[model samples]
Target: MTLLNVENLRVTFRTEAGPVEAVRGVSFNLGRERLGIVGESGSGKTITGRSVLRLIRPPGKILADRMEFDGIDLTRADEKTMRGLRGRRIAMIMQDPKYSLNPVMKVGAQLTEGLRQRDGMSAADARKKAIEALEAVQIRAPERVMEAYPHELSGGMGQRVMIAMMLIPGPDLLIADEPTSALDVTVQAEVLAILDGLVRDRGMGLIFISHDLRLVARFCDRVLVMYKGKIVEELAARDLMAAKHPYTQGLLNCLPRIGGSQGPLPSLDRDAAWAL
Candidate 1:
């Protein structure tokens, strides 16, 4: 049932000075479960997620002792094979819908494009499937929404469209990179609920990358705390509040409480050795 296995995965970007290591010896196993990787901006969380799909751009190199998805070796996969798997089997819902979605394309066209590429279905069939996907994400009047452009939809609606498009191909694994970071609190909850429901109902593995520790604890099954390109702590989501690592504890204490009076949030004291 292990869907994805990454071992000793290292990613480096070629800079003018030299190679800048982004991810360092990161390894994890994902089954049909939700795994949250929580960290700050430069913690290499996003890079690790991108590396799984081999989405690293030029001058960026990904080296892994072993990187396999469902027994298929991703490190050795050709561009064509990776392309077929990228959106079809292992879809990624990026952080911002504004950049992720095509502004010129109608929502309907963009949503069904994945299905068209994967299944080669007729236009009518693709549209039907697109509508179904929109509805699946709890979008009301899916047909109307589909006809509209990305700019016409609200931020939340646009995100829903992105999710629908990603799920239209029925990917076995979903990598959600800061999915609700841009949404309001209420919209964040709604979108998380939709994602949670889909993952559970379809029994698909989810890798949610975020900087919100408390949200990850509440929404994910397992939590992996990353600091400076390494996983410093891994624990059950329920036990995240009781995490042992200093970094993890610092992150937990940083969450703002409604009733509690806080003077100043405790900043994480990073050790130089932790990066190694």
Candidate 2:
């Protein structure tokens, strides 16, 4: 089944200079599969993800020909319906754990709170589920970690906690934006493994957004290459090496390979049409 579908999606921000389009006519479909959106910082990758949950704030407008999730039109859904969908049906894990989590709250409380929001279970039930969720993310001594505040935990631990909180509700779709950017290479791999396992085991759809073409090629089933607020190419991950788009090829060539001599990196020569 197609879990989510976006078509002709456009997003713009109101500014003093003029209206700036962040996402321009982007569209894609997601099933119970791992899909990666790869692009540089201002490619509008993150904005598209945020628009999925209708998280775009004031002064930012989102217009789409069709933005449907499981046959429900997200652009037309009321606030009440969106409230029930967010965090429960379609959860998002933001870029940085530090800003995503509440600094004053204990990890356990935050995790349990997410569970409560979805199921309205008893406090004890929520706590038990919290522990189980933490354990599922491979956190040892889940009980001890639960009692610690976000600041007390390391960057990796905090990210795992964020994952646990988002997964506790068993969301059907997970949108992760630059999820492992702050972690060490080893930790990033571990985290990615955990996310991959969850998607495989639970049959949940995943949108893994990042700038790392190599990682996306290795992890996602399909890849969407975005540039200047537009999707320039979409191809199967296995065939990424054969990508015909100049932007995609440029990104792949930019990755430093092991034992490769360090010299001037090849820059992407952008055409005027690519900016649109």
Candidate 3:
């Protein structure tokens, strides 16, 4: 199923210096599969994700030829319509749980808020589903963990909680922005496995945005490599090593190899023409 179709999507911000273009003519289609957008910090990766939900506020303008989700036009949807779609139909798992989670609220209370508001479930049912969500992410002692506040949990557990909260609403599409950036390898793998299982079993679409070339290539089905506000290369994730674009090659060369030459890794060579 084609869940999202975007064409010529552009994002610009009104900075004090002048108008700055963040995304330029970006276009792609997302189905019931994993799509990864890989880029450096200033490559407009986050802006692209925010633009999809019209999260870009005043002073930031979004213009698009077409942006549709499940055959509904997203670009023209009113605030009320977009609000209903944001958390219920399309969810976003942000990078850090420290900032995303409520520090004052209990884990269980925060997790069940969406269920109570959107699904209109009774308190007992919402709490039951909340525990199941925590277990789905393989959290041990979920009942104890639910009573603890967000500040008391470890980094890995906090991240898993964030994932559970996002998935509890049964969204059709999930946009995870650097969901595993701070975790150790073991925890990262565990989180990815949980996400993959849910996507496979429920047939949900995922848009994973990150800067790690190797991880994206291994974990995603297709990849869009962004540079200077444009997609420099698009290919199957398995073929990342064989990418032909010079920018893509430069990024691949920057990755360190084990037991290879001991010198520092190569630096990326930026070309002015590549942005065009």
Q: Rank the candidates by TM-score, best first.
A: 3, 2, 1
Tell how far residue 43 is off in model 1, in angstroms: 0.4
Candidate 2: which stretches are off by over 4 Å?
Answer: none
List model 2 lDDT by residue over 12-64, tens digit each.
99999999999999999999999999999999999999999999998899999
Instruction: State TM-scores per candidate.
Output: 0.96, 0.97, 0.98
Q: Model 3 residue 102 lDDT?
A: 97
Per-candidate local distance difference test = 0.91, 0.93, 0.93
- At residue 195, what lDDT does model 3 achieve? 86
Give the alpha carbon lDDT tens digit for every residue of 1-276 in model 1. 899999999999989999888898899999999999999999999999999999999789999999999889999999998988988899999988889899999998887776677689889999999898889888989989989998999989999899988898789999999999988999999999989997889999999999999899999999889988889999999999899998889878877789876788777787787776
What is candidate 1's local distance difference test score? 0.91
Question: How displaced is residue 149 in candidate 2, in Å?
Answer: 1.0
Q: Give the TM-score comparing model 2 with the true structure, all chains together.
A: 0.97
Candidate 1 residue-wise lDDT at 21? 88
